[model samples]
Target: MSFSKSFLVGIGTGLLFGSGVTILCIRLQRVAREMDSLSNAIAELATQMSVLAEHLSTLRGFKQRKKRNEFYSASSGDEDEIFEDANLSFISSDSDISKGSKNRSTEDKILDTHVLFNKVEKLFEGDEKNQEEAFRLLSRSAPQHSADCGFHWRMSKACYLVSKIEKSRDNPAKAKDFLQQSVDHASSSLKLDEKCSSAHRWYAISLGSYGEHLGSQEKIKNGFLIKDHIQRSIDLKPNDPFNHHMMGRWAYSVYMLSWMERKLAATLIAAPPEAKIEDALESFLIADRLRPTIWKENLLYIAKCNIELKRLDEVAKWLEAADAVPVQTKDEEEAQKEIDQLLPKYQTS
Candidate 1:
């Protein structure tokens, strides 16, 4: 009676022990594979950081170019030399930018810059914080996604913020340099993805700033390109209010060209760029409708366009709307300051 029972018990114990060992071996193999994968990733990241350091070291050597003559033709953009100077191009080609035909978001993050885009958006969202910190984050994250168009545009935005943000404005030379970097990063964004609306939008805006800060010739010459790229941005993403506001700015500048400026353009350019106050007003109004109470700049420009049209009542109406917009950032404070300056003149007129 005891022999059969003992034999059966031993067989069962042997089978259980073998099963436990098999499961443990499988788990150990899995953990080993994961560790190897993690180690490889860390090594690759270290290599990228090293390469990025070299590129950025070269970037630190950037010197400001001398001002061009006023007679410089406003025909072509003539910006190759500036880009050639910065030499900040990145070759990171393995970043995951595989969104299909249209943009699809991963939960809250849009534009694949390793979720840094969301962080960057928040950096500009609330009361202004350390500008240098934002620039550092973008620079640190850039090399890993150098081939990613998203990183380039975001880097351009960070450069813009450092250039024009309140305290940063104290250093005009640094601001100007950062502004050029903004243009360079933004242009790189376009080279990587021409169809990207944000890239085109930022590129146009940065180019416009470079022209405005650098010289009148640059502004007047880049005007057509700004108009074209901003138009493309609008065409690509019709719902973006920022694009509409930019388009309005282009139109307003054209309509406000002085008689001398107009004569010069007519003489030099066979078909000088043309725009009307009504067109600007229309674009501004559309932006107003698209995002109410967000952009006081859009409201101020709307008032300016109306002032041009001799619509004093409408001017007052828009100024009131501009005044109502809550000011958070220094940029918003500056926009409000402009409104304050314009209010007395328009109220009396």
Candidate 2:
């Protein structure tokens, strides 16, 4: 009986030892996984730091340029006026007053619209207060202005400009309101003249901007409309670089949407618009080809798309190109910051 008890005790001890070993191995595996995650997190942090350094360097450069008044020269003068007029010309033309007032003649109304357009153009370069003043002036005259065919386009441009200023001020709700007004004016312009490419472009831009303030489901719902309007703009003006850039931006935004966001979108909508990084890259490439060095944002966007696709080698080239592009407006300065952040990652890699 003693011998039998010894053998049973040995069997129990063996089982306990084996169980302990198995538990230890499982714990080690869990630890290994945790270490791997930590390592990845650290690497990501490092990359972000490198990008931040680049942005700091760009900021320094911007300050130096400011001291030398380079930015002022780049954004001012006759060249600047011509550029603005080219984009805002929908309102620059003369138009007879649809409403006959005993006091004002057709020529007088046309001259008034022209003067207002010039005032708004000058205000475009001013501060937030200036933009608000411009908005007030435009608002007072919008009804009478829309009576003139040229006024529709001008009012649309004014609304868009105000929305952009609001967005820059971090008042997205106010921006959305202005964008809605822009859309209304753009629609009126299109109704009066269906072939107005600028109207289509501004309309698409307003819708896209408005989408940023919407809920996930509403954004998805408007995504289709945004795509349609942008495409129409491109069809109307195939050679316009801005239209292609807008298309690229749309694709990039769609591609960046998370799976959960997409699922939520799908549940709310019959069919959500689909986008791929490849499409975004192609659109950006086409825009770059059309405008060359006109915009740094295009190059930065291409680099971002490449990074998403894990094409690390190509990212450096695009970033370098972006750095070479001259920074002028606030938007370009913002793009410069992004480029500065990204350029260091690939350079060190």
Candidate 3:
């Protein structure tokens, strides 16, 4: 889109200032070619980034895990390893946001922030009631850390989960509203700190969800941006399993675009996203290996990707794996039902 804009503006300005059409046309055409070359270079760079993300994701935890193994080997003890988060930088009670509340002690402000953060964190258990309550609290809370990026990202998450609940309840209008809120809060988070990976992740998720219902044109319009943000998230936090899972899902969606959808994208989207089912399967496999059985949907999608690839031999294995995962939430139950429906066809075949 920027490419088109630059091309048009350059040519228009050239003609408006009484420049010769021949020279002007040649100059602008060269510029267009250079822009196209730059765009292709960008696409190649993106491919490299995805490859680097997948290869380095497991490396992040290797040193820590190896140290733990060495400690256990020497101690000959079976105590669960404990990791403490010494980074309590977000609990800033003395920050400018708390200037009006001079009466509150620093400890009190810190405690209140932790309490609010914990409350929101606990509500992410996929319970609709809990998610709704969490959203309400996030909407009303005015803590010292209210301006913190961490707080806004959590708000984005709470809004996203509430949107999920509304979507499950078939309340499309309400769901859309919450999804927008999710996107807005995520923008606030990014504005505070562009380096935050989870903010990028939630922002991608919320925008993708919102785009899904806006028909083909809007989906195409948001496709590049949604993908870029998610890729940025993966590059920043490669060790996070959910980030890989999201990349897999995004790949699968693009790979499965219908004939008409592809045509629309070709016509309307300057740089429509592209992916192969193989890419989807590879991402899903990486996610599975990173944290086996962590998410029922991940396993389910792995099976679905195999089915699409005509790899019937591999499909049941993933389906069975998904089945063995305990169903703890409504989403997991639904995923299990899908796995059940797929399991029989492949088992008998």
Clash count for each candidate, listed in order shown: 0, 1, 0
What do the candidate models score in CA lDDT, each in turn? Answer: 0.68, 0.67, 0.70
Candidate 2 Cα misplacement greater than 4 A, ranges = 1-119, 125-130, 148-150, 167-173
RMSD of each: 14.7, 32.1, 24.9
> 65 in model 1: Cα distance from truth in Å?
39
* Tens digit per residue, CA lDDT, model 1, 68-135: 22211111111221112222222222242233112223311222342354445445443336556768
Q: Write the per-residue lDDT of candidate 2 for residues 1-349, one digit (tens) a residue.
A: 2334444554555567797765665565455556655565565456545644544444343233222232321122111111111110111111311121222354345445555655665665566677677778888987686654345655666787778788788988887888888878878877876776666766777667667677877778778888888888788888767778889999999999899988887899878889999999999989888767556788888889999999888888888878887876667788889888878789644
| TM-score for candidate 3 | 0.68
User: For model 2, what is the C-alpha lDDT against the true structure?
Assistant: 0.67
Candidate 2 — worst ten consecutive residues by lDDT sum? 79-88
Give a tens-digit lDDT track for model 3, residues 1-349.
4656667777777777775764777687777868775675566456545544533432333223322211111011101111122221221222532442343355345445555665555565437788788888877884545577777877887887888788888998998898898899889888988988878887887788788678776778788888899888889878666777888889999999998888889888677889999998888888777666555788889989999989888888888877787776776778878888889898744
The lowest-lDDT stretch of 10 consecutive residues in candidate 3 is 71-80
Candidate structures ordered by TM-score, highest first: 3, 1, 2
TM-score of each model, paired residue for residue: 0.66, 0.63, 0.68
Give the 10-residue window scoring lowest on summed lDDT in candidate 1: 71-80
Q: What's the lDDT for residue 173 in model 1?
A: 84
